[model samples]
Target: MDADLPPLTEALVQDVIYAWCSSAKHEITVPNCGAVWGPEADVVSVTRARLGHEFEIKVSRSDWLSELRQIRGDRRCAKWYRAHTLTNAKEEAKKTAGLAAKGSNCCGLVPPSYFWLVTAPGIVRDDELPAYAGLMEVVPYRHGIHQAHGYRVTETRPAPRLHRVKLLDNQLMAMARGVTLRYWQQRRKAA
Candidate 1:
């Protein structure tokens, strides 16, 4: 986690994600997830789970891959997903194909059942959009709310697609500090 990130940015990311998850009809659980098995293996600042599904929250491409490398080799980390029934070998194979179709920039984080890329305006350039398309749904952050546009992943894709959304600077920083944005999004809907 980047210690330099602004405190307010971290708060916004956490608040938005929490709100989003809480509003979901399903019984969603945000776990203390991290990546520690791959080459870039490092602690994922914030991760979440719902119905045995897990997702990693990333604000940038570098952060996303760093966490992914950690889980690539460490069976203990990989086992966490299996023990929780979050994913499997068969599903992993399928996710790779799905990500290729979407042109995702992420380094394949066990094929997310759901992936969210929350960024600030002007942060994600136009050319970068196509690279991540279909890979994960984009979640845009604006004002103080985060909304789901539609389902980006499907049986054809299987893996959680990336969602790109613009978030405030404070929110972005909060995510860097390990805040859960799903919770914030859910809270907004409940209100």
Candidate 2:
């Protein structure tokens, strides 16, 4: 860590991700509970066209590895998770769907159309990311003089579209509800 840089926390990374998504013209940017994916996203953003983007924030390398393990399943053979190709991963998921139903940790469902992993600088390398996932890093500002006090989120690798379907009305509603609930919860906490 740079001496001038503050340590990255999950909340800080999440705030950076939310700001990044909002600046990208996401119509709806919310923290937590998209409810469209099998797992709750750290941050979820929706474009005006209703395309969904899910961001999973990790402050440490261990957390990142753990996430991959949970999604890819620990028992699967090397070819499955190591394949990296979306088609290959999907085929493996299909093969393991029964295993998932049998209480395995693997997630058989397709993720949001766009999936990203957000982390602090040096925590995840671009080459380490799975083919289907993108990488975003929160690093000290690299541009201009007399900079702001906070870090900026930069997309080191663009995530490929994993699913084609636009978010359905109910799914959008669920996200909206989550945002509303979070708002009140924060307000209450501040009180």
Candidate 3:
């Protein structure tokens, strides 16, 4: 690392992602919600049940490997689909449940939903990444000195499903709490 260079921070990567996604019209405005769900992911943005995206920030290869281990080990993330049991569809629900409960890599859900790996620009090329992974590049500058912008996303997968994520436990509560807390906090500050 050069003395003039700045270390890439997770926050910077996330900020750029937030801006980029919003600019591109993604429904998820918040970042890092998936962290509380299972293993602490860098960012997981969900737009109701229609779409979901996961962002993994990696400043270095080691950082990338480490965070990946957490997700890999967290068996809870293996299942992202749910069973839909509508009236007159008991048989379908049963079958969906059976498939959902199946082991990982079961095609339980339609994928290509962008799992973004935001890293230092040019750190990892797009061709080098997994087919399912979309790459977002960031450049970190000194705190409050250099701003992160012009981020690029390449080879991104579009995640579309009736159920983007299956609520594992109280993750929904946490998200709600975050929304309420932020609302009040901002209101109080303005008040």
Which 10 residues in a row give candidate 1 its minimum summed lDDT? 148-157
- RMSD, candidate 2, Å: 6.8
lDDT of 1 by residue, 1-191 (tens): 22443332433444444455555432433334333112221112223331123333355656645544543435566434432323343355355446645776652434333433443333334444322221322334333433422211111123343321122233224333333555676789999
Across 1-191, the per-residue lDDT of candidate 2 in tens digits comes to 57777788877777777667666788987776746554466788889877778887889889877766755675655324433434353454344444555776643443367878888777776667787888887778756432234778777888887756566555677788898898899899999
**Which regions of candidate 2 fall more than 4 Å away from where they truly are?**
76-110, 142-149
Ranking 2 against 3 by lDDT, winner: 2
Candidate 2 versus the native: TM-score?
A: 0.73
Against the reference, the lDDT scores of all candidates come to 0.37, 0.69, 0.50
- Give the top-scoring candidate (TM-score): 2
Report the backbone clash tally of model 2. Answer: 0
Clashing pairs in 2: none
Who is ahead in lDDT, 1 or 3? Answer: 3
**What's every prediction's RMSD, in angstroms?**
14.4, 6.8, 9.1
Candidate 2 has its poorest 10 consecutive residues by lDDT at: 78-87
